[model samples]
Target: MGSLRESLNRFNKQQEKCQSTLTSIAASAAGSKASNRTTTTPAPRAVPASTLSKSPVPAVKFSNDTERLQHINNVRKSPVGAQIKKVIDLLFESRQSFTAEQINEACYVDVKGNKAVFESLAKNPKVNYDGKRFSYKSKHNVRDQKELLKLIRTFPEGIAVADLKDAYPTVMDDLQALKAGRQIWLLSNFDSQEEIAYPNDPRVPIKVDDELKQLFRSIELPRDMLDIERDLQKNGMKPATNTAKRRVMAQNGNILNKPKQKKKKKTEISKRTKLTNAHLPELFRNLNG
Candidate 1:
């Protein structure tokens, strides 16, 4: 009975050890699973508040119909289209692609009414229209002085300033620098006052001979403007003003319309009455006789 009781105690002890070992193994497996979850799963990143929130665009306003029309005229004059010259200016200035609906929303124009303009833009070589949106395709990609200089050199006659403004926004500064450097010449049109740029050719230097230089130095201009004017008139030049013609006409009119003075009839009595002056009359009496 003593040995049996001792054997039962030993079996109870072995069972408790086995249970404890199983519990330890299960706990280790659970810990490993929790560790793997922590390592494998990615954490969520925080987004920028600025990127999430955008400011609303301001609405365009005009005081009157004339002001609104002037604004529209200015937009029409922008560098864009061949005929219409309106919608594509927005695309050019923004340098972004926009759909027909988007363009209408931005400009507040009746796209349906100006359907022909949009159709023309689609066919225009300077505009790039994909199946969805349209973008501005610049004719000249001049950004700096070097590119501008290269472009100016290409045209020997001259490039129009109006055309350059279309290519580069800050072309005026580049042109000014070029002019200061004596690398280009800016000439103004007589009637339009539009500037034309010509490249300065360093290869051809202005050369004057000694005789020509002396002739230029010895040139004597007439001080009398009347002589100069007469010579110019003789060479088939006409008077620019009517002042000279008016002066001559005024003088002639005064002479023709002037009043004439009547002469006194006292000369007939002088020869007969010459003897009545005593001594003074005697000296003149021989002449009177």
Candidate 2:
């Protein structure tokens, strides 16, 4: 009798499992039919980070003509010049320092976005990963220049000409020029105790806008192919459909600055109802009656 009871329990669990499998199949079939009947656009689905662990790419925007010319010169000077500039800009703008591999990953995104531009930068002697960090080893490294400027810009109690002399190689020339240009007094009374520091109309670092930053944090895009073709199309930045490559290159930055989708705030949604007061009499009156 005990064996018989055990056999019956096992049989009941198997039956329950079969019932659940059947129920799931029926629901799936019904869902398929519903999907076929629907024509409305569904809400966008977020891709899982596990499935798409790659960071979103963003097109880097040269903040001003000075930066643009600098980038152009970089491309002309070093094979890795463009990439070095890009990494420098990223480091300056970033809230934290990144590893060399991370920098390489970001620059390689350029390779994916623009083959020619990547090749040009790849030929640079100054840009190489030291198995740990990407270094711009130029005699006049922009990375060093920018770092020194950052220190100067954020110098507490302000920096003196003497203090800056060690950091800036051309300090004497810069001081003399400032004096000749009637700007010597700008740093003459430099304080070193105050929290806020602003030195002699120092070259302010370029700041990427919030929108651009969001894209960078989202997309992780590279410098040359600042604008991906797919993104450009969405922003209505299409060429004459058959425009020259040069023409496309000329308009690359313009297209990349295209607006991204703004996330709408979700309000509390109530359950949807098909019946209103007008239809209630015809639909519900019969049921009530």
TM-score of 2: 0.18
- Residues 152-268 of candidate 1: C-alpha lDDT, one tens digit per residue: 999899988888876655778999999999999999987689999999988888878999999998988777666667777899997555556667988888466658788876653
The weakest ten consecutive residues by lDDT in model 2 span 134-143
In model 2, which runs have C-alpha deviations exceeding 4 angstroms?
1-78, 109-131, 134-289
The lowest-lDDT stretch of 10 consecutive residues in candidate 1 is 75-84
| lDDT tens readout by residue for model 2, 1-289 | 9999999999999999999999999999999888886856587899887779877779898656787567545544545445556765564445234464565465432433455644444555534444444444333322344454555555445555544543334644654554565432344342454222244453445668999888878976544443555556778896334334667778784356658889999654233434556654645443421
The C-alpha TM-scores of every prediction are: 0.40, 0.18
CA lDDT, every model vs. true structure: 0.77, 0.54
Flag regions of model 1 displaced more than 4 Å: 1-86, 101-117, 124-132, 137-141, 205-289
